[model samples]
Each structure stands twice: as C-alpha cells, then as structure tokens.
Target: MKATIERATLLKSLGHVQSVVERRNTIPILSNVLIDASADGTIRLMATDLDLQIVENVQAQVEVAGATTVSAHTLFDIARKLPEGSQVRIEAADGKMLVQAGRARFNLQTLPRDDFPVIAEGPLPTSFELPATALVQIIDKTRFAISTEETRYYLNGIFLHVAEDPAPVLKAAATDGHRLARVTVARPDGAEGMPDIIIPRKCIAELRKLLDEVDGSVHIDLSPSKIRFDLGNAVLTSKLIDGTFPDYSRVIPTGNDKLLKIDPRSFEEGVDRVATIATEKTRAVKMAVEKDKITLSVTSPENGTAAEEVPGDYSSAPIEIGFNARYLLDILGQIEGDSVEVHLADAAAPTLIREGEKATALYVLMPMRV
Candidate 1:
C-alpha cells in the first residue's frame, strides 16, 4: 500500500514478521508479505506458511491507503541497507511498488493481496498473561531437550502443564530418550487454574525471537486446536500437535542419597577437555569421586585419554558415573552459580543436579550404562 514510514521503525517490525515466511513454499504468495495501510497513520503486515501465521502493526504515514503483497525478504534487505533515520516513501500503482529514501530508489514487483493467506481464527476461550522474562527463562532451560526425531510426533514439542506440587505451578518439559529437562514456574495472575498447553518446537522458537526486545508482559491465549502469543506490536499463531506428552514426573529420580558439591565452571571445563578424546558417537566422560575430590577422565584407544581433578566439599561415599558430555554442558550453560550440587543414588541410577542455592528451576539426567 502507499505509505511513508521511518526506516528504523519499519525495519524492526519487518525483521520480526518476515521470519515466519519461508523462502520456499508450495504456494507462491506464501513467500510474500501482505502490507495494508490505513488512513489513520498505521500499517498492518501479515505473513504465513499455511500452518503458521504472523500479524504485526507498525507506525507509518498513510498517503493513499491500500494493500499489496511483496517479497518480505527483498523489502527487508532494501530497508536495512538504506541510511538510518531516513524517511522512506512507498507508493503502489499498476502492480508495481516504488521505494525511495535519501539518495536510494527501488522498484519492486507486487503480488495480489487476495492470494496471501491469513491464519484461520479460533474461538480461544482460555486466556492468560505472564511476564515475558519468565517465559524466556522456561524456554531457555528446556528447549535443548526437545526431541528432533520426527518419527515420534508426540515428543516434538515442550509439554506445558499444571505441575502437581505443593504450590500450584506450570511446567515445560522436553526429552529425546537421551536426556530430559523440565522447568516449573509459579502460575501468575489471570493464569490461575489454566489448562495445560503443549506448544510445538517451531512455535516456541518463533515466540522466543519476539521476546528478546520486549520488556513488559506477554498475553497468552489458547484454543483447543491453536495457540496465540500477543507481544505488543507482533502476534504469533501456531497449530498445536494433537498428541500427548509423556509423563515427565515419573522419570525424575525420587531418592538420591549421595551428593557432590563442586564448582560448576571447574566441573564443566574438566568434562569438556576429557570428552575430546572420547568417541564422537558416545561423547561419554567418566566421573570418579573419592574422599573430597572429583576426578573426570575419558579413555579412547584411538586418541589416548584425558584426566583432571576438581575440588569439592563432599566427603560422602565415592561413586563413578558416565554421562554424555553434551548433556552435561547443556545443563551447565543454564546454571548461574559458582557451585552446583549433583545428587546420586548410585552410579547406575539417574543423576539430579541443582544450584547450591536451588534455582527456581531444576533438572535430572538419566545416566548412561558406561
């Protein structure tokens, strides 16, 4: 449509909404962005890939109000390369668009706006709001565990549900048969007694991208078949996976007696160096704890072996455990403390890890039979 918008403001919203449009699509218009300008100095942008859709509102100077569909990536590229704070002038006529700002000028071809798809509307009955920071934390902690195995469609998304704990809570969990990660946060106001929502992996990734610059809260609304995230200027909608997530509570170890408290960095670095010699298929690093020190080692006939020691404040019975080096590194990345406590019932059982001062979040790892 015909409108004038500030270069920086237009780029920000376009950057968020344009990501939803895939470069290649079965339908031609699906690769383009729908731009609608109103007489009230506001512009609406829409993009979709049939299943997922995004709608965003941006500020603009409306001249001749109308609508058009153009290449989202191409427009974004042109706007980004233009001078900062320059006023961009856009006009649509005769199936062509003329873009001008400062000394630069671009003429882009346009597609019919009617061909662009809008995500179907759902009568979402359950709605709630939560702090954007809290949602971001939950995603960061558990997204690493989401299964990429497409054959098992049920395990492809984060399981968001009401946790059965002393305090009412909501949790998100993911596992790929190798390692499991679950994060629980107290339910916020308006979110009281909300039904569980299992969001797909792509949806979580898209929603997380929008939250990076947001400071206020995000409004969450869900229908039985769809989920929508309202992040002020932008909105993300996705179809939910019609399958049940496996019960994660049962997998968490209930009784772990021996505890190993060691500096998180020291432990992480030791495991990282030793795992270099281990086989790529099984990057297993062995942990041997005795008296008051924890020794990490990996032996590979092809590349020799590596061994190192990390001091700990533990005098409990010694234990030896083998784990995937990558899994341990994932959990360590989420840890925010100098020391981390590892709980073990036995070398053959699952290992539980928590911050010395327990984080609002916790994780348990199923040990490998090394």
Candidate 2:
C-alpha cells in the first residue's frame, strides 16, 4: 500500500490504534497493525490483541490501493518523532514497509495483511447513543473500585445496566470487597431493556482515552458476547467477560443511620495528615466521630501516633471505625462538591459516602479493624 498522510493526522490515529497491540505476542502478526489504503482517499488502520480491537480511518492521498501489516509501536514512534507539519509517505515493497518523512527514513518489516486476525462482526441487536462526557463521568467514578483479583474474575470490570427505581437511569458500579462505587445518570434514548454486561477493565481503560478527547456522542452496540463503541471515525470492539457480576445493590448500605457532613477537601486533608503514622503494610486510619467533630488518627507501634480533628456536622452517638487510608482517599477524590455526606451505622458496618445532596453517585467503604 502507498499513501501520503499529514504527520499530525497519522500520529494521532497511530496513537489510538497501537495501544491495542500487545508488547509481546505469541503470534507475530498480533503485534502488528493492518494498514489498508483505498482509492477513496482514506487509510484504515486496525490493531487487535484477540480480546480487544481498534479500527481508525485517516484521510490520506492514496497512490496505490493495497494492504500490509507492520509493527504498531515502531510505526507510532517513527510518526511521533518526525518533523512537525511534514508529510509522511508510506509504501510497501518486497515484504517491507518504508516510512519517509523529511530527512528521516525508516524501512520496517511487514507481515502479509491476510495473516492479521479481524474480529468477526455480527448483528448487534441492541444499539444506543450517549454523550461521551456522561460516559466518562460514570467510568471515572467507578473505575477505581474495580477489583484486581484474578481469582474473582467477575469483579474485575464495571457493571453497566439500566436502573428503574424512582426514575429510569443508567448505572455503572464496581467493587473490590473493600470498597464500592456506584454512579447513575439519565438513561439515553433506545437504552431501555438493554441486557446487563460486564465490560472488561482493559476495555474501560482504552475507551477512556477516546472519550477524553471527543465531545460528541458515542454510539454503543451490544450483543450477548461482544460490545462495540463507535466514536466518530474510530471504532472499538471488545469481548464481554463470560462471568456474571455479583449483585452490587446488595453491598450498598441502606440503613446507615449516623450522618456526618463535612467539607470534602478538609476531610481528605485530615485523613492524609493522620495517615502518615500508619504502617506501610496496613496503612490503616481510625475515625472517631462525636457531636460536631471528627478526629482522624493512626497509630503504629514502630512509627508512633498522629491525629487530626476536622469540624463537621455530626449529631450521632460517638463511633470509631478503622479504614484503609488509600481507599478513603480514593473515594474522597471522586467527590466533586465541597460538602461530603457520610452515613455510618457503627464501627463494623459499611459506611456510605455521597457528594453533596445528589444521589447520582455513592460510595460504600468497608471498615477495617484497627
């Protein structure tokens, strides 16, 4: 294939498609990206790692209509280092791909395009569109809580489903046994009766890259086995995890009676200060709440003790609870508003946290024994 593409355009598309290519591959072609040049003035780039596939189209001047595969990362690096505003000319000759830009030239080995695996596309029965910003919000709120444990593979992804309680809404939730994050937004059109699916962690991460740059709508198509996202000229398809996600609604605390309202920034700072004395292994911090004040303290036999009191609006009986400092900070970081509402039942019960008065997003953190 032969084509001339703008350096900036090629670099951006390469940056998106190359990430799906794994660094090491059992199959040589798996580490390469398929480049197809058509007479229609566009070049199609595709890369896959068996589970996830990304396809992007870039505007180019096609001199010859053909296809070939080349190392994804190497091509990306070459494009990135090329001179600004230079035109990149690529051509395949005698099983090698030549990349030329200004004074720099590179000859990369190529694999037959036929050897590259293409993910099969089937009829996607359910399709809907949602604003990219809203989707990013859901992912940012819940992604941190996804479990990294391989044994319980079901908890390794965020669960996406429709919620129909007080009103119809789309909800995303994730949990790692120690903590849980749940976020809801108004359901998009054509999302009703959509089947619940567990999107793999890697898919969520790669999709986030695209969502961060685009302000347009994202078209979502899902079936029983796979999910696809179309954002402008780029398309991403991923296999759905086979395991069923646990019912996350059961883990969210409902009867936590003690309520504590405090400034999110102040609480986060207090926890950070007291956590300095915590042991590196456990990193546990204890919270003592009484009246209108809450004290965050950590005690380590080897590091001594540290405590900080933060003023809050709390009227419940005195309660003490231990929690992982890292987990507390993660939940606190997600709070967007100044005021944070924390609901607690006792020292051992799970505590619920919310941002301001909005029920759109909530966090549940399990207590750690000090």
Which structure among the candidates has the greatest lDDT?
2
TM-score (all chains, Cα) for each model:
0.95, 0.98
* Residue lDDT tens for model 2, 66-116: 999999999999998999999999999789999999888999999999899
- What's every prediction's RMSD, in angstroms? 1.7, 1.1
In the range 74-136, model 1's lDDT, one tens digit per residue, is 999998999998999999888899999988999989998877777786687778888999999
TM-score of structure candidate 2: 0.98
lDDT of each: 0.84, 0.92
Q: List the residue pairs that clash in candidate 2.
A: none
Using TM-score as the measure, the top candidate is 2
Residue 191 in candidate 2, Cα distance off native in Å: 1.6
Error of 1 at 209 (Å): 1.6
